[model samples]
Target: MRDLPVLTGDAVADAATDWPIAEHRVLGRGRLNTFVSDTVVTPDGATMVRDYLTHTGAVGVIALDEQERVVVVRQYRHPVGFKLIEPPAGLLDADGESWLTAAQRELAEEARLRADDWRTLVDYMTSPGCLQESIRVFLARGLADAPRPEGFVLEGEEADMEVCLVPLDDLVAAVFAGRVQNPTLVVGVLAAHAALRSGREADLRAPDAPWDARGAKAARDQELGELEAP
Candidate 1:
């Protein structure tokens, strides 16, 4: 048998690459997201038009209390027609706000809570094939109750959202049983579980860890927008 290469932790990194864009156009613009189409040239000399949504990115917080309970919110997702159990999360719509600030703000606004300890749990691209939405999930401990953000009022689906705490072990089981399908919650639960089991929670990335993919995505979006402009 051929000798296999030794496994190294460094081999799993994701690299950034882009194809040449021949054309770009906005198909539609909604309140929070934009639908666009791009004509990209493949390396094999074929050109294809791809339609996708341009998002503002987002952050989610897995707030764990002293008893290993995770604070979560049940909110209705109109497009999916299901009320998903998700961690406190929100978009990066506020200009110039850092991702950690966004995560902290969301935890308060959506769950009426705050945390003194914070670490990055994971960062992922949601539907990278068609959507440009990047999400950062944070593990927040040292929990305490806090008032909602000033001038923040829940509306529509958020108005009916319910906040509750569930044991982390239960959440992990739900994830494996296919009971919870929200991407953020699934990834956050599994990552947090592994971190705790491996005793590496403290060694996770800092709350303000550098996120180059998000910055690169924003820059590419700007260039595409400029190209689509008259």
Candidate 2:
């Protein structure tokens, strides 16, 4: 049997430290144009270089229809080169857009539906080792047909995207069977199924749940205005 470690600790506990970014450089930029490389000094004073993507964050919605079916969309992801089945999701690029608002917009744009009840299922960082993208998943229920947000035209893969209403359990089975492979969809379906089976709706967070690590460091850096001499 393979050895595994079971970690048990107080999640609410954290250690405080003022880490320093000794140096920074812009390697290049792409469609998400921004400076995204860095050199920093560890607390122990060791120098290290790192590169990461900068994002404004994102949201995914697990939209449930009247029959308790989940909304699934099949779209092509260029980088991964896969036509993955996924839930409605989008980047939080709109100025001053709150997380819940972004989730609502993405749901409306991709699924063309709105919900009567919304709860935050989970918030996580995608590929934290090399990406600075923070994502939140929301559980949306009481869905009904609606028009897409104004001027939100679908183009490219999104224009030709295929959407289907899938039974929640069937979607969960597809996730486990390697048929549905999008990160957001897998996480969401498994979570939603477990929550529904366990009757743990009371444990769900409100739509406005605080995301502490959602670019708080960048905001803090902007406030501190250079913590140490260059």
Q: Which ten residues in a row have the lowest lDDT in candidate 1?
A: 5-14
Clashes of each: 0, 0
1-230 per-residue lDDT for model 2 (tens digits):
99986656775443334457676665666786344566778878898887876666789999988787999889999989999889999988888888899998888899888899999997777777677677899999988888999998999999989889999989978877888788899889888898889998778999998777665746734633453326
Alpha-carbon lDDT of model 2: 0.82
**Segments of candidate 2 deviating more than 4 angstroms:** 1-9, 12-18, 33-35, 215-217, 220-230
For each candidate, what is the lDDT? 0.93, 0.82
Best by lDDT: 1
Residue 170 miss distance in model 2 (angstroms): 1.3
Mind giving the per-residue lDDT tens digits that candidate 1 earns over 41-98?
9999899999999888999999999999999999999889999999999999899999
Query: Which candidate leads in TM-score?
Result: 1
Give the total clashing residue pairs for model 2: 0
